[model samples]
Target: MFTINNLLDIMVLVIFMNMQEKLTILADSAKYDASCSSSGSALKRHGDIGNTAYSGICHSFASDGRCISLLKILMTNCCIFDCKYCLNRKSNNIKRALFTPEEICEITINFYRRNYIEGLFLSSGIIKSPDYTMNLMIETISLLRHKYKFGGYIHAKAIPGASTYLLNKLGNLVDRLSANIELPTENGLKLLAPNKDTNKITKIMEYIKENKSQTFVPAGQSTQMIIGATKETDYEIMKRSSEMYHNYSLKRVFYSAYIPVNKDNLLPSLNLPPLKRENRLYQADWLMRFYHFKVNDLLNADNPNFNLLLDPKADWALRHLEEFPKEINTCSYNDLLKIPGIGVTSAKRIISSRKYFKISFNDLQKMGIVLKRAKYFIVCDGKYFVNNLCFNRSFIESNLVLEDNLLTSLKGEQLSLF
Candidate 1:
């Protein structure tokens, strides 16, 4: 004996409960993956509600210590692949749900209209198979692009085993695409995520690179590697990254510091919060991409890993003290690149500006080279800046330290937001 009003109320309550459940499962599952750069778009519809900013945005951080935005969710949480570290592994007992392509489109538009998000970031646990799962994601984007004509940003994961045709179809529809390089090496993949073939991931990245010239993946393809989970050394990671960049012509390679989400006897018992390792890798990555640093030039067997205390640039400067006092006027771009505080941007500015006038030490500072770190590395004419340190390489290395905890500063002080 229920009236229409009672039926409507019941439907509302059920929908609310379903949303709560979906939110918990999705946000929890997405905590591990950190390739969240949303900067690969050239499309601009005049008077459009959403605009893709190259600088990107950090909407918020979840409790598991990852940023959240764009209604980040999995179309389905029912994963078939059993990745040892993942909570959504096929064997794990977790509540799961699947959203239809239309469901996702509806949710995205509703969220956007309500000012809940800028767009959609859709990732999924492999349901049935990688190809099937990939197709579902593709359909979601297609619906958004063709039917809804959603000009808003869409970040979609290129499932490792997904077909090139599917990926190419996706390239035209979505803003940015990614194929997760979950681990540093094939051995790491074999151990942690056995079902995910490393070769397939590499092949997909290769395809993206080949097609980028003609069709283009606007934001370009990006990949993520989980650090500290496997035994892969930092040297090994950087070497692989260098190859990926050269071969794939990738826009970026992200490093996700390993946080042990599930209990496994094989995994480390010690909770190694990944922020420090993550930050150092980012600095090293910057050196590779912009500063023209080779992996071998930056790290090797003796220093198999980045120093947790100091940044890669500072660490490199401290180690190579003999190369210091590089003459500003005389040094080539290659030599300027070797200077600690001088990044690619500063080096170019200094080189370009010097042609007009003889740039002095003060002028070098004005050009954007961080004098604090650069002072010891470069000399203006005959004078040294940071060479005041009396210690040797190892001694200097021990002193140039950074803070351990980033989340505290990022969260409490809101430093990360800026």
Candidate 2:
């Protein structure tokens, strides 16, 4: 009762349904990774379909605060490794899906045409072996680049233990690449992910660093580390971050608060993700990256962890009271950055404005400085901004803590219906 055309149409419909199911499963699986932020690549080529400079891909954010400008997904959710912290581990009873190279290219081209995405962020769980998975990823990107002519921003995850040959091929095809270190400490990795090798991970990073030319990984490499899953201190984590920056030339080290996905005996029994700890680490990372603060300056063996009440800069300022009341007009640019409320922009503004005219306390406010926090630490025109200010550590500490609490309370308050 059916013609050949009728049977072919039915087959196409079934394939479309299957593709939709794969997308739903894989996209949800990819959400746990926070290292997919895209920037620093202005990749545009002749005869290409898209550009990274189109609409500022970094500006787009999902409702839950994750970057969603890219068609972020996995090649497959089937893995051979059974990591304790991973949701897609082999032992977990979750829905799995795989996208073939052609399917990935088709999806990316369609998404780009619809203006739903400006880029592609592709990662995967290990299938068969690391090399096999890397090969699949490479093939997908190759099809996107050559066949589809997708010149948009593409970020790919380099599988650790995959050969340098594949690593080089993948790096050349994508805008940026990341190889997640998984855990901060080697011991934590051993306890949580017994199959992963720290040496192999570093080797991938090393290879990327050594072979990086102008056309190869123009956005460079980044990595992610899980926090609160191990017993490592903040000092240890920052120390490793510093080393990676200097030793391997890493662009960023993203910190993900370990959200417990599996209930293994070794995993922590966390009721919720350690979001606050993760925030503090990001602040400290900013200090190390932009403010040029060393690990020892922010923390040490004596005071290893960050204070939950005070931010890293504020806590550091409180510890070194001798450096307080820094004359805003006379302090070095480096010292200007040490002030709690003054960020990189305001600090540069302070330096540039002072060259033309002496900056007053009123000018600081106009420059978008947080006067409440900065007032206690800075002086303008050789006079204290706060009249008759007490320099006592406890007094200043209590004031900053009170201000933070008030701000948080205000933010959490809901508007009443009249």
Tell me the deviation in Å of residue 239 in model 2. 1.2
TM-score of 2: 0.92
lDDT of 2: 0.83
Model 2, which residues run further than 4 Å from truth? 1-17, 54-56, 413-418
TM-scores for the candidates? 0.84, 0.92
In candidate 2, what are the lDDT values of residues 1-418, reduced to their tens digit?
A: 2111223543453366588798988898888778655677755665368877733565466766666778889887777787899988878877666788898999989888888887899999887789988998998999899989888889899988898899989999988888889898889999998889899999988888998776788788999999998889988998888888888899889888888888888988899787878888989999998998999999999899999789999999999989887999999999999999888988998898898888888888887777889888888988786564576788889999998889879888322110
Query: How many Å off is the CA of 396 in candidate 2?
Result: 1.6
Give the Cα-based TM-score of candidate 1 against the true structure: 0.84
Stretches of candidate 1 above 4 Å error? Answer: 1-17, 43-51, 54-69, 113-116, 213-216, 356-358, 363-369, 386-418
Q: lDDT for every model?
A: 0.74, 0.83
Top candidate, metric lDDT? 2
Question: On residues 134-169, what C-alpha lDDT tens digit does candidate 1 reach at each position?
Answer: 888888888877777676778888888877788888
